[model samples]
Target: MSGFSSWSRRRRRAVIGGGVAIAVITGIGTYVASNDDLRPLKVDFVLGGGDDPTEYGKQLKIQGQFGGLAVAPDNTTYLFVEANDETVMWRRKPSGAIKRIQVAGMNASRATQAAVAPDGSIYLAAEDLWRVSPAGEATRVIERRGCGKANPLVATSISDFCGATVTGVTVDKAGTVYVGDQLIQTPPYGSYVHRLDGKSIELVAGRPAKDGESVRPSNPAVRKGYDPPAGTKAKDVVVPDVTRSGALAATKDGVYWNTGPGIVRINRDGTLSPFVARRSPGKISDPSGPFDTVGRALDAPVRSGTGGEPGDGLAAIPSRDEIYYSDEGTSHRPVLEGDFRWQGVESDAQKKLLDESKTGSLVHRVTDGKLAPVIAGVQAIATSKDSLYVAVTTDIKYRNTPENSATAVLRVQLPEKN
Candidate 1:
């Protein structure tokens, strides 16, 4: 689940004390008051937390770290768990029966993300792409063809090759699969968006760059701003500055991904645009606004020493254009001036601050262009008809114990849309 290179860079500098100021400002009273609307959405623990992974009759216990999670239309839950040095898929049915799914011929441990199609088929992405049918049969749909020494600059198409790293995957209502690929190799070092329809794969946005070429344009033109002339080839009309961090979603309109600039949308016609604007570090402009306004704001220069908040898990609504995403807030970093160092009290404060930042992991809903925070401390999210399923870390400080190890899946009822 952690294949995004940008995420790895952010995790290195993540200090527990990063959210101390926010905690002090909000306090307990203000925090409670602000989240009053979320109180009615009851959070019921569905699974996890025990000494070991076991299934006894209708009850199941899951331990160790987990990756992606998805909920089928029938309310069946699928979870990827890493235990005993192997990755396995666990399926929990509506009747409370739990069983492990054997995804033959593939290393489930390397799966970075998962999505369930409307027909109840599960899609997994990693170095390759796979589909597990509702009847429990798994097939490798896309074979990972290494880039090798091939030159992306002269190559006309990437239909046969998979990206060096697959960070996110999602299935639309029509059963079409969309994949976000981050190619970190030398010749084609950039991000790409690909669509897999049946047996054909097409590059929708971004392109493999030449050596020393920039993939992210400082001022990327969006939609009509940079429309190709008559008869322009799809591969030649590249949309720059597009990137992803393990988050990708699709609606009837198009595909959405979290990038350094914010959430970007690639329309069905291959036109690129901005969905949400990044205002500052850990902040974003209101999602409900004119597209030109958001696009213009995104074209502005990014602030120094800060990459915009990149979303984590993403899930699209079944029959609606709405989407849900998780934001992992920035980690705290300390600046050293001269020889000044932290004292015992300061060290204790840092520890306390780190603990307080756990609440900063937030889930948000994007509906009718409005972005609303739904819950806190969520690591990943998946959606069903009337509920949102989330994987939440029970104890961020320690995961060595049964009570604290691994994340617990919780189901939260969704509020009626306006």
Candidate 2:
């Protein structure tokens, strides 16, 4: 009887245990199904060092100073890298070899921006827009042109300051390319967004101003671009400020970029509008236009004596519907070296933009109807299948100083199913 009773108790206990296990699993599944944070992406690895590097994505090793990172349609990450005293196209293969991809008929100098096409190719913006296929085929599109000395542009007194064109490049999912351009001379040719479709190129938005014709800005300094003080020249008075396009990213949803203290979105229909304007902690009247708050405050100007302009960084992860950006922390915040005077108009604008400044190098996201903080001090960002990469750059370097030798790529892993 005793043996039988003991066996009966053990069998009953096993049945209860199995029932509890099933109930617990069901509860956990229900929780995960409702909680997005439960499936968060973890930090994977930081790729930096010699030619042979760490593999974060299958068989892929990141090498060199990665300036622009583009994730191809096949989920392969390609970096427009600056190294070995020149710029080169670096792509990681499925078999884990890091190789330099030579695009025929194209040079890598001045390749500061890159974008990926829907068909697994890449475009680099330099002297011209160069397209390279996944199989190493190359073609040059949109021949870069600078307004000549006879273009009627008034030059600046800043020694050797001359005309410039083609600031950056971005491509939409439909294979349409957009080039950002501005006339750096007087008469202040306004910023432009030009469209390139196959064999055709034309202006889709932004009108480049003619002599004595520039868009008058609500900001006094910008208005001053059109009308300089009694004695100062326009080119000398109208310095590069926060109002120009910094970086760009595109999606089927729309094209997004940072102009000065604001985020500008261009729709497929070619409508250009400010999505969010950067706000400084000073001056109370809601910081202009239908704008959203950039959390770093007028953070850039408050930290005076800082190098670089504000809003110089931007990136996007289309699959996640998220765009990450940074404020170079100052708007039109100019740093003068050797024998420079503080002009009245410029100082007034800086004072207004920087008043009550809250300071920090911030990283923020634009998604849904919000521009919120994701990280701090991450001045630049890029994204691929299951990872996000961010880097911080200081404006301490002078012109063309590639000898800095810092080539670190920090990767953050996420629970990305794709």
Candidate 3:
């Protein structure tokens, strides 16, 4: 009787344990179904040293420096271009070995941007736009005539500064390539975005200004009222503070470039309209104060000394109707000792953008009325279907300086079904 009773108790315990396991699993599944955070999608794929250098995806490691990055349609292969370096292409296999794709006589100083077509053809900007090969041949898509002397950065080599300085590029499923020209030299800065589709080139905004005939901003200096930190240099170039703004992404309706402080929609009909005007933190306007003070604030490494918050890069989550961008944190912030500054860095803008956020480099998702940060410290970013890759440029060494340390690329995986 004792033995039978003991066996019965063991059986009962097993049944209870099995029931608990089922309940736990069902609860977990329900949680995952409803919670984005709980789902495995909220994670980042950090690929670097020790992580299979090649297994993550096809990586192309360019020599001189990684200027721009683009992913192929199948989402398995990647193309990385190093601007201004003769060793232009670095291709990484699915295994771990990286191979070099050579482009003969392709010379570009500050070859700052790159993009991939739906057909897998690559386009990169140096002084001009070059059509690159998946297998390794490079040809000119557009060439600069007189603008070659100006050393233009071709966002759209189509007409060469027909709009402004091309600083950004994107493509759609139909192979339509959109280039964003930083028209800082001309007002209503960012008045136009250029589009390149096959043999045609067109502007996507207000009237196209005459080449080199736009309003330019004056140089910045330390204001009598505002004193910069010790050793801060005064700015000499007073050019407009329009940064390389906008990123290209496709939507069900059509292709779009998110530009300006607010996200503006560029329609196929050539109409430019406000898509999300008053969204989060609102568009950080050009800071107003003594121009001298602004200049003093701008006196940073990158901006040198200027009082403007130029918009940088942009990206979007199609189904979410949400767009993300890198806003120059220098909008309203005061000058700090450690912040990165160009010739015309704006002090106030930095303070404004960094008030709540810890890392000025931030990621924001567009909600109903405002833009917010999703991640910060993003220097350069690219997306492969379900993954977002961000390049965080950490340590630096000047010309001829020993490479003490280098920046790293962070991979964030977008939500995917289990």
Candidate 4:
């Protein structure tokens, strides 16, 4: 069922959100960074399969490539979801130990971004929206069909029930989760922005659609209120008037996400602004510093077509003028008729087939409308406090070399003026 080719779930309906769970992680190991000369330091963010060359070499056959990542709000830890291990999520602590997090009710789908609330509550945008409890319990705040399924015996949960497709999710200091819903599958090909503020989930942006309704942005408004329909709701309500594909990250300033072609910010006042946009295709434009670029005439920054054409993964830092994100290349074609369809796809033969494919991801910093490469071969990026981290995939081990690729962590210090 894996590697046959495609982004799992696109899921959380990725292509946006990543794996999420509820709870606080324990037994996290800590490592202090060396500030000997204030130059910069790269350290192991987490320790896991990256050590076992054979492990990743084997996994690459089935896993394909790396998935989404997010840093916790505590400025202490971060989380990442692997392609092969779709259901299980890994949390990297300061101690460098990679701990396993079981996201309750999550489907074996591809994941997107993970947002950490100020209170340490983890909001992961995968499939639907999942809020991980401090006790490590995952509760589906919003449910989407194919994103997750609840056990029939687990009497307290809803199943296959979100009314829209979630692409990105970001939470504010107040713990409000704003979802970028792309009515992807539904007609109208519409997009929207939704908010789960306090008492209920409301449609902060985009026209609301009832189940089975097909309409576009130009159509007259049917309903203007944001209310969740009762009884098995994991389906499309309606698409938004925004970009259909994107990811979200939040800062005290506001929530920002990939608005189709460029990066846009949504202020606390519900205004749409542009942040980092491309001047020419794969280049960043100017004039629009980190301030509210909404309504400003900006250029479009298209995702690179080098690797798998991975869109930008965003992380909102405390700084208003800058942000950290992942810029990956969706550069390869997958092998369809291989043993990947088999159960144990890590055999030497399978590994050989996997090695034939080449792809990479990177983490970059965008500030004052400038681009700087922080880490290359980065699968996902997340930032908190004075630290920035990336998941550099080592899937190349299967290709054969004296030093095989080891999945490792890369870090960059703040004041990223580069």
Candidate 5:
């Protein structure tokens, strides 16, 4: 089950062009408005769309599917692209010069995620954890070690180890590296978040389940389409599909990550708590102020039913204590197949759900315990001091076409705080 679970997760990541379709609302620039207070933001095309890699920086056209995005302190942008089965990191300086950096000794076909440290070091998370120095030197910081064959139902103890599957990576303002491990093959069969300082690795949040232990559901209700065998107790049934984690973002307080329904934080004090509550189905509204405590933030009825399942993308502005998250929405069937086209729908209800999922997929800004919609159809997002960068697919219906499947980055200016 563990091996099959790992393959299922990777297959989901391999699908391209799942972002919500971007619509141009105005002539000056592409402006998307969410609500009245959340003003319409103009999106400028940064770069993307080309047939060849050599033509990348020349005509502002880069070929390949977008993987991840990050911005350094000096406003330099790092865009990860999966081209020819290899992960390529493109660095865009303040002067707009684009340079491609590929880490040596890494597998070309792995789904690589990247995060930039304060000192400009790039951390890549694939099967293992690696650090690419500012000068383009790559070093394997953590090697992949499997837990071998251990039954998750009766394993007495699970070791704290970096396993074969790593879902996401991020660095905080203090230059600490945090990795999200799915721990699919490891005993206990759940997600774990690990923190790596200079010398040691610590399991900050989550752990392998002990013998005969059942992991609690993060959200209130069981997800749709999950059914257990007859007479199986809820506490005894383990579902590997919903027990995954991804997309880590760090702030001064701690690190925030996607745990299925919503985001949770591992605080500076070494405590785990909910940062954003699991969204309920209804109209969402903007709250006025930050919650007094983490518990209040978790329980407060700020709004719900806006963002999709947390973890599509997460970005943080440590200076402002603000975080941005993206949701690709939920679907009844697989959004993309081998050819990048939408899969066949089973029913009208499923088609309606798919159509509704497109609109529910959005990027939101979380500040002072309040969540507000920023834009629609964001695949990945990054932040600079003054702007927000988003990767999106221009046309959704025509994603099967190579030209229409190109991913583009857009820049949105941050509004002045009142």
Candidate 6:
């Protein structure tokens, strides 16, 4: 391999310590005590269903396979969107019951993410963008054709929702919508944090600051870190996947997101920085940026013995700055007889390996600069003031017959006394 490629590969492996194997640790007590409420909130999962069981049930349902998660500013409930093929929005009441809202041809194109403005206007992303109101009315905010993009997966087309799939969205107090585009397989292999001004989109960072002041790289903390591969400079590192867009939530100070590599927060003035910088580094499932160093935060693989897949899916409750994300294994092969799960391998290891390779999910939690595992075998996740929600998919086959697979939406809470 060339120097650059070798560097890139080494950097990727170095991000995770000790190769891909993970030693399991379970205890939310230490991590939860540092945050607000001083107690673990309640968690529950409500299942989604379709009129046709054979078509939607037993398999992944569009409504069931949730993509983006956002909490309403008022704190009454949470909102989420389906993946690319599904454009419907589902509202989860505090009771853990989900109601599907039909926007009626609301941006018929594919949707990768969604967010809500302070006023409760739902911003849904497809190849095109639409704004849905609490009253159920929908209107187009932007379209792909007019945005100067030829495809939905390019970097230059970030503004059009045509390139670098829309992975996460947020709205500021001023009503400016911040959209995170994870563009890989394209130039600038990093995420473009865009600001929606009226009907147009503009790059917020890697450019000028407010008041026409030219933004320069001056922060030693930001500049002194690891560098990308040769010729593949940091300026050109496009985020590898949606995992970089983990739960784009805005605070009075700035915006926060979870990438497969680590958690990052962009300041109100557009200074990009790390939120949680240390975790075992490796090629996490759908990781967003270049992996060059070890001890960086990484999404736990759905299973063990798996490496180099990208990670995606993140959600967080902003009021408390509590965040959650999942790292899915790129491989999907099931564990057969005599596999490690059958050996003396521990169940947690077997489960992580299977969840990454066959069926399962890995969940990570971060707050006040501390990180720890909260759950596994989750594919998608969201958060609210009162709870943490996760979607986990597992595979199943029985005696030469293909049994129906199961996808679960699990809710978890901290023990109140903690």
TM-score: which candidate is best?
Answer: 1
Off by over 4 Å in 3: 1-64, 77-84, 92-98, 108-113, 125-127, 144-164, 182-191, 208-241, 244-246, 276-311, 319-321, 330-360, 367-370, 398-407, 415-418
- In candidate 1, position 414 carries an lDDT of 45
Task: Evaluate all candidate structures by whole-model CA lDDT and list the values in order.
Answer: 0.50, 0.43, 0.39, 0.45, 0.51, 0.42
List model 3 lDDT by residue over 1-418, tens digit each.
1111123443322111110000011112222222223211122222222212233332211223444455554333344434343534554433444454666656533344456787767766543567777776778665544433342333343544432555556676678877655544433344335577666676553332235644332111211001222332211111232443344555555544443333445545443334433222222222111110111111211211133223344555454455545544332211122111111112342222222111223344443433323333444455554445554332233553212222233344332223
| Model 6 ranges off by over 4 Å | 1-43, 47-68, 73-86, 95-98, 107-112, 125-128, 145-164, 172-175, 182-190, 206-247, 258-260, 278-311, 329-360, 392-409, 416-418
Q: If the candidates were sorted by their lDDT against the true structure, best first, what order would they fall in?
A: 5, 1, 4, 2, 6, 3
The true-structure Cα RMSD of candidate 5 reads 11.7
Task: Tell me how candidate 3 scores on lDDT.
Answer: 0.39
lDDT of 5 by residue, 95-177 (tens): 76778787565544233356888888887766677777766676777666755664322322233354546667888767878
Model 6 poorest 10 in a row by lDDT: 16-25
Question: How do the predictions measure up, each by TM-score?
Answer: 0.67, 0.59, 0.57, 0.59, 0.66, 0.56
Candidate 2 or 1, higher TM-score: 1
The clash count for each model shown is 2, 6, 52, 48, 1, 35
- Kindly provide the TM-score of model 2 when superposed on the true structure, using C-alpha atoms: 0.59
lDDT of 6 at 88: 53
Query: Candidate 4 lDDT, tens digit per residue, 294-338?
Result: 222233343544324223467755643557565443332222232
When 2 and 3 are scored with TM-score, the better candidate is: 2
